[model samples]
Target chain A: MSADRLIKLELSKLNVHLPERRPSLREALSSARPQVVARDGSTHAFKREELEFLAGLLPEADRDKLQLPILIALEPKLGRGTARISGEAEVKVVSQVLEKEASAGELLIYRPEVAILRKKLPTTTQYLFLW
Target chain B: MAALAVSPTRMELLKLRQRVGLAQRGHDLLKEKMDALVIEFFEVLRRIQEARMKALEQLSVAHRALSMCFAIVGTLETKQASKETRRELQVEISTRHIMGIAVPAVEVREVERNALVRGYGLHMTSSVLDEASREFERALKLLIELAELEGSAFALARELEKTKRRVNALEYILIPRLKEALKFIMMRLDEMERENFSRLKRIKAMLEERG
Candidate 1:
């Protein structure tokens, strides 16, 4: 196979584990068992502890607005190692966890912060690749 | 004259050189990736070893507890309790990509902890058997987690080794041979052109002298 083709295949496989669509935080919390199906047809469950942490971050009204498995955007343009955390409540919670200053709207996190966020909320957060 | 004769073939040599450079870069990057994967694999393996030991120890403890319960409550009653207990334990398993490999996300429900949803007939029920069942159930959950982790670690390790071999082959053998072939072709092409140019010049001089 050509090098380009191999690289394309590798890049395509990077996000196969991501859910087609994320559930609302409220829906996830209310359900007896909260889980998502991956592209490869496997179920991934959300941890109760991570859900509770998310609950503590947002108001009751915002719970429905906030989505489970908050996307951590990994764009190549942002350089190889950096990632982004979007959404107001998601940013707030992540910022607090990483002990960083909370900015309004989206947050541009470096690689170390991204790693920390992932470590803290492995099930509740997922990496999103943007072209 | 020699320089002019070899000028046309220089372009091919330059192109071949660039290709070799790209291949070398790719090999280096892949080698680095393989090393990183090996490191990650070994780390996971270490964790798995610890988890396996702990889980097996806990399983044995639970089995011992169950045996003691059987002795106290009678064998038939303990067996009956085991049969009556709800074993609808579901694990929500999902795949997470580590590098290129898929690893399972095993999530087990807290089955044996629920007190209100009692199993077995009320008349035949003994708290000792329930305790035994619960202990065994807890151990099972831990064992399942350990199994998933160990399985993933092993799979990742195998993949890492395979990738390392490929990287080594490309770096140490294929790329080098291609470069050598390319160098030989360029040298031969240059020598042929030089000889052709010298022959042409001598013929031109002889014709001029004859004229």
Candidate 2:
């Protein structure tokens, strides 16, 4: 029973670093100090240069559609070395970045592609683990 | 092949099964955490490589600038300028959580100050000295970032190795042993139930014969 309790505690802690609310691209670009509050109440700030780079990647109209700290869903069901980028704007941006045809509302990227995306958008991207 | 210290009962079997389930789930989650740590570690390593190259180059340039100062302003004057200059470089180090582990996140303030802010005295300041200071400041900034990256890589790797060990324990040891024990209990329970039925039948036959 104690082992069960410990496992539950470990499972609960997997996503504590996730932000309670993500800032939009426009908000991050405009603000001098743009940060998100994690579920555990820690602050994660976006680098200004990364923000500027993201702003350049999207058009003005699409700025609001794009969110800060893009969720990279890493699910075991997707098999190893694969992640899904959901949300319409997220799929669009990721597809363009990877030079792949854009899908509607979701896109799956391989490990190397994920590495490239993270390299290009370090502070702007955050990994989300899914069961 | 040590036996589990539990009676061969359905209740014990169920408990063992639940434990195996928990262990399996923990293993998968920890595995995912390990994979993510590897990615994060490699990313840090890539960044560190670039930062190291830039920092090392700038450092060599700074050294060259210092040598030039030594020749132009004389060795003692350059050494004196170095002494007068502010050398305390402070890095903003805060803890950032990577999964359950906390790694340091370091930020550096604007280290490359103008000659006036270098505060080596107005009269003693020279172009060569300022150049050396500026280059060294830039190098210091890059090195600070590099240090943070290296620290994170090591921390992540340590966490990754730890998680991997847990996963292997469950996958290769705990889960399999639990399953084997469960199988042994089930077999023993079945054998006992069969023996009980046979004993009951034998008693019934003797009683009927006596009657």
Candidate 3:
């Protein structure tokens, strides 16, 4: 029973580091100090270099549509290591960065690919658990 | 193999199934965290390498400048200049999270200061001494950056090891054990039902024979 509670607690904490309200790419780029407040109330800052790299990937109009810290969703149903990236702007940027063909609104990447994406966009990408 | 001690009942089975589910979920999320941590750790390490190189080079330069100052103005005078100069440096240490782990983000005040801000007596401050001070100040800034990077790296590494351990326990111990116990209970329940059915048939046959 204690073990059950611990596992449940761990699961609950899996996504708590995620921001309650993620700062938009435009907001982050324009602000003097770009950061988001997590659900746990801790702040996460976006590096200026990462923001600039993200800006280079999209046109000015898409900056607002493109959220900062783009979430790479991991669902058990997707299998152990596969993750998905949704949102049109997010798909565009991820597909381009990974050099994969651009899909419409969603992109599915495997574990190794996810690692590469995280490596390239540390400040701009985060892992989000689903299901 | 580590079957949890429980009766072979439906209630225990239900609870065990739930535990397995929770374990699997925790394992998956922690694995993800581990992967993210690896990326973060490597990034810090790479930055540390660059910072280490720069800082080391600057330190050597500072040492050379100091040696020259020692030769130009006797050793005692150079030592006196260093004593009078401002030596207090405070790092503004805060934290940022990476996959739920709070790694530190340190900011140091402007380390490279002008001669006047260095707080050395102007009359006693020779050009050689100024040169040495300038080099050392630049080296200090680089060193501070290196320290921040190294600190973050160590924190990330510690968290990574912890997450990896949890993932391994779920994968190799808890989940497999729960599944094994679940199988054992299901098999026992099936065998019990079959034995009960056979006994009822035998009793009916005896009754028919007696009639």
Q: Each model's TM-score?
A: 0.61, 0.85, 0.91
> For residues B1-211, what per-residue lDDT tens digits would candidate 3 score against the true structure?
6677778878877877887788887887777767767867887898899999999999999999999999998899888877888887677888878888887777878877888888878877688888998899899889988988888889888988888888898899888888888888888878878999999999999999999
The runs of at least 3 residues in candidate 2 whose Cα sits more than 4 Å from the true structure, single-residue gaps closed, are A23-32, A48-68, B88-90, B200-211
TM-score for predicted model 2 compared with the true structure: 0.85
Q: Using lDDT as the measure, name the better of candidate 2 and candidate 3.
A: 3
iRMS values in order, in angstroms? 5.8, 2.0, 1.9
Docking class of 3: medium
Residue pairs in candidate 1 whose N, alpha carbon or C atoms collide under 3 angstroms? none
Encode model 2's per-residue lDDT on B1-211: one tens digit a residue.
5655778988998988889887877877777777777878888888889989998998999899989989998999888888887777677899876654678898899999999877897888789988988888888888888888888888988888877787787788777778889899999999999999999999999999999
lDDT for residue B201 in candidate 1, whole number 0-100:
100
Q: Which TM-score does chain B of candidate 1 obtain?
A: 0.81
Clashing pairs in 2: none
TM-score of 1: 0.61
Model 2 chain B: lowest-lDDT 10 consecutive positions: B95-104
Candidates 1 and 2 compared: the better one by DockQ is 2
Superior candidate under DockQ, 2 versus 3: 3
DockQ of all models, two decimals each: 0.10, 0.47, 0.60
Q: TM-score winner among the candidates?
A: 3
Q: Chain B TM-score in candidate 2, rounded to 2 decimals? A: 0.89
Residue A48, candidate 3: C-alpha displacement in angstroms: 3.7
